[model samples]
Target: MAVTATLTSTERQIGIAISAGLAILGLAMAAVAKTGPMALHGGMALVLGIALVFYLGGALYDHPEPTNRRHAEYYDAPTRFGIVMTLIWAVAGMGVGVWLAALMYWPEATPAVPWTSYGRLRPVHTSGVIFGFGGNALIATSFYVLQRTSRTRLADAVSPWFVLIGFNLFCLWAATGYVMGQTQSKEYAEPEWYADLWLVLVWVTYFVVYIRTLARRAEPHIYVANWYYMAFILVVAMLHIVNNLALPVTWGAGESFTIWSGVQDAMIQWWYGHNAVAFFLTAGFLGMLYYFLPVRAQRPIWSYRLSILSFWGIVFFYMWAGSHHLHYTALPYWVQTLGMTFSVMLLVPSWASAGNAIATLNGAWDKVRDDATLRFMFVAAVFYGLSTFEGSFLAIRPINSLSHFTDWTVGHVHSGTLGWVAMIVFGAIYSLVPKLWGRDDMAWPKAVEWHFWLAIAGTLIYVVSLWNAGITQGLMWRAYDEGGALSYSFIESVEAMLPYYAARTLGGGLFLAGAFLCTVNCRATMRAAGDRVDEADRPLATQPAE
Candidate 1:
């Protein structure tokens, strides 16, 4: 029989009643739909919040009273679920990303329909990476990191599954809503309020689970990486809630409008925007760096103090850097200047992190040649270093003037996304899958080698074409004849980009093809492992009689 212990009658009763109550609330709200999108969204949030309360109540009751083995098993189900989902979604999310990149080069590639347009696909791409890709990594890694760092299992399995499965379902809703032309149009907070509220409930439970697990920790000193991870999760939840304040169209229906308008909206959006990068992309990944670098290289972190300093520095400076996105716009000039200055200041902490990762690998150069996983991460750190420096440069007012709305911005984002974020995800997945599956044999080892080279080539071709195209477009837009008339028509710039666009399409195609191979290899590896480790990978039931 299966070891199903986490779920009790009282919990189930509570969950049912709660779901009914939320259903009633949602119907009542939808009945009064004329109130406006914001009101509708608020009403929907109320429903989701209530349903989550029900689930939590049940989860609490169903959880087994602690036994030594039971306590250790508390974390296994959720962690394994999250690990599996991360591997699966990493491929799915990246596939969407590859599609989105190609569309940039071929505007006509996406049909002119509302759902298929650039606006919608752009959010789909962003949501997939940030939420589908990055979000799952955080979930899977945090569970693993927390267990190892705290020297304890998760607080409870039931709630953790709710958090992982629940969060991914929310990602599904948001991505589909976008492709279906449902959105709130806020940068990084594009999910309509209804969707956003679902995330909030899932995340709060995530926080609770994390804290409860910490309470059970065997270790006295919390690992530094966990500190960074916790802050990222907590802060991003706050940022997501505050910045996504909105009006909704209906409950269970995804539609909403952000509260902020004009300059204020721009400020709020980017404030959340930059920090999403700071905390979500950078900080969480830093935790990965700490664990993987040390574990892979067989060395301690370079300096604990440097990690602390960099963490606080990035947090303090980055919140103010979003206004740099609004430079030369209606956002207050002083705010823009502050953002620019802070962006420069932000570089120190960012580099401090980069320096730490690179330094951790200092004496392990020989290891880099044979280990593909370490190679991916080592190169990712180098790209992270380069991208941060480039970010600070572009945040400058003059540079922003040249780069804004051009392909240069596109190139920059891909450098960080494909070059940094995706590389780390690749490494983390490689690290997680084997251990979780307990298989010595990877389905196809050489396929991994081929996949890595293909990704590198794709990323290079994709970014370089955009860079060349961006500079050309930026220059052409500014040029004028001596007669004070236009030197080139808008169509002229479009015509000039055809060759570069074709090159970009080819690059993105290669990336997509490689992702397909990865998915196949992963599936085959799972099949090869079969049931042997599925049982072993779980928590043990009893101690041996000694």
Candidate 2:
């Protein structure tokens, strides 16, 4: 029989208190929310509150006595839960993304539905993939990496679970609120003041858990991966608070107004936006790459000094590069110039990290060839270099003049997200799933190879088609007739994008399919683990053990 893990006395007490507090707060919110989206969210909060109460109560009653067992040397439960959440959100996010791509070409596909419209669903897709999928992966892997590197278990069990659960709750609120047309109108920071506040609580707890665990490290020196993870955590918290400084219209409502106005607001928004790409997307994943790639490749990082230089370089340069998004806008010319300069300089550190990963795999060419998982990491590093280079070029004033507000920018983002970010995440997932489940390999290792090819093909088609369409649109916008009038009408560009949009939809579908395959493979691996455990527990001779 499988073992049932009951809550400890500390966990039971904390859970009961938190559940009670949430239930009270939910009732208060519901009482105030007379109608609309706020009412819906209040109802949700109330349900969650009640559910948690019963959940904790059951645990308390069923297991009155706390077990005197100690935690393992490394805590893996939260990481396991996080990995499951990551897979789920990946499918949901990418599925929405594919639907959005389809709507671009077939606008009437879901007509007369506000919730399903592109505008609302766009944030859903972006936040779902970025925060839901990528965020979970980072949190999960960071937990796993931190413990193994530090040679210590997570410091506080309750805090880690709280952070993960609370973070997901925030993601749920953000996504469902978007569908309900509730937003503060910031790009990546769209979740209203209430959601933002919840995230702050969760994030602070996450930071505490991380630092506390690090402080108890058995290793004398903190590993390099921890530095990157620290940067990701600290910088993201900083960016989130500054950019999301807003005043809610009322305690019962979802509307809010940002504190910064005009150019200042735009600057802050992109500052938050671009760095969301930096710290949230890039830095955390780099931590994964540094640790997992080296271990998988069975080699040390090529240059510790280079990695240190790149870490600081990325930290300094990325903060200023957000201004590049305001290049031709009302922002000051000097600010734009500074953004461009920092962006160009950023290529150095970006490439350094990418090169470091590739160099680490120099002597592990056989491993890369043999293991599809390692190949995913190799491809991810290449895409990281390529995307960073593309980002630098796009940041230049002249280039931004052409690529700004175009599908080229979209392609550029996917190049990083689908190519670099998602690929590394896949590699890490494949690397982790078997080990976490106590299996020697994936239940179906060949499926990983299929997923890899599908991913590559989908990414290439999506990016290349958009690149062509963007260039075509940009050139046509600038073309002049013999009379010096605009040659191509705006509709012409719209018509031009139809084929590419169809192509993009197909590509997105393929990627989503690959994600589904991963889900199947992972689930099978878990089942296999359970089967193994059952067999191990079975009696061979129908006799009791002495």
Worst 10 residues of 2 by lDDT: 537-546
In candidate 2, what are the lDDT values of residues 1-546, reduced to their tens digit? 111143565576687677677667667766787776766766776777778777776666555553333333356778888999999999999999999999999988977978988899999999999999999999999999998887766776677777887888889989999999888889989898877887898899899889988887767888889999999999999999999999888888888899999999999999999999999999999999999999889899999899999999999999999999999899999999999999999999999999999999998899999999999999999999999999999999999988988899999999999999999999999998998787779999999999999999999999998998888888889899999999999999999999999999988889899999999999999778732221331211221111
Best candidate according to lDDT: 2
As a whole number from 0 to 100, the lDDT of residue 376 in candidate 2 is: 95
RMSD of each: 5.0, 5.0
Model 2: clashing residue pairs? none
The C-alpha lDDT values of all candidates are 0.75, 0.87
> For candidate 1, lDDT tens digit of each residue in 281-306?
88888888778777877888888899
Q: Report the error of model 1 at residue 233, Å.
A: 0.9
| Model 2 residue 327 CA deviation in Å | 0.8
> Which segments of model 1 are wrong by more than 4 Å?
1-68, 109-114, 249-255, 530-546
The top-ranked prediction according to TM-score is 2
